[model samples]
Target: MGYTIKDTRHLKNILRADFILGGLTAFTGLVFFRPLEGFLGLSQPFIILVPLANILYATAAFTLATAQRNPSIPLLRLLIGANWFWTLLSVALLYVHYTNVTTFGLTTLLFQIVIVGTLAYLEGNQLEKMA
Candidate 1:
């Protein structure tokens, strides 16, 4: 009889973290829409844009996680880049919002930093193991 080693605990943790981050990003993006709209007092098509931005960020995070799981997979690298891109964009947006005296921007910025920073750490660990 032959035994196989399939220790996927680390992978599972990565996936769980990614999922949580992705969900949070999506939620934040969605929640910000209403207040942003009221603050900006925008109407019609403009109001919808905020939610779309959130959805895009969520999509990027999802794709990034998929790529992390299979590093060797073609296009995974691109997805990873996209993930970081959106995260940084979100950070910048938060910074701007806070600078303009928007409430909770500080909290959002902190959460974004922690979540994205943790993802970066996990990604580094995965890459180290693969190497």
Candidate 2:
């Protein structure tokens, strides 16, 4: 199947949204890690590393979103894979810390899982259409 221009636009939008959300997550984690550590009851390394990882992911997302032509299928596949990985990782973290995580922390993890998973699904669906 061939993709239309509209499909390209939709893919770009999804990538852009992922970039924006990831940037926000990174910024919030970096700026408020001290408080987040206490509130989330997670390790300091986890708090700091997540934001760093997000920074890289966001940069990749933005680059792909702004490509002059349609982004490559392989790259999009990798992005979708990363989104799924992050979603699953969040779920694992939630499970690991369920006993100690604050209500707010649990909520935060749930939101991350849902949002990232949704993005992964959207990206994957778009890719399937292109394929």
In terms of TM-score, which candidate is strongest?
A: 2
Off by over 4 Å in 2: 1-6, 129-131
Question: Where does candidate 2 have its weakest 10-residue lDDT segment?
Answer: 1-10
> How large is the C-alpha RMSD of every model relative to the true structure?
6.9, 2.3
Q: Model 2 over residues 30-126: C-alpha lDDT tens digits?
A: 9999999989887779989999999988988898899999887767778889999999999999999999888888898999999999999988878
* Alpha carbon deviation, residue 62, candidate 2 (Å): 0.3
Error of 2 at 122 (Å): 0.5
Question: What alpha-carbon RMSD in Å does predicted model 1 have with respect to the real structure?
Answer: 6.9
**Mind sharing the TM-score for model 1?**
0.55
Off by over 4 Å in 1: 1-8, 36-72, 129-131
Q: What is the TM-score of each candidate against the true structure?
A: 0.55, 0.90
Candidate 1 global CA lDDT score: 0.52
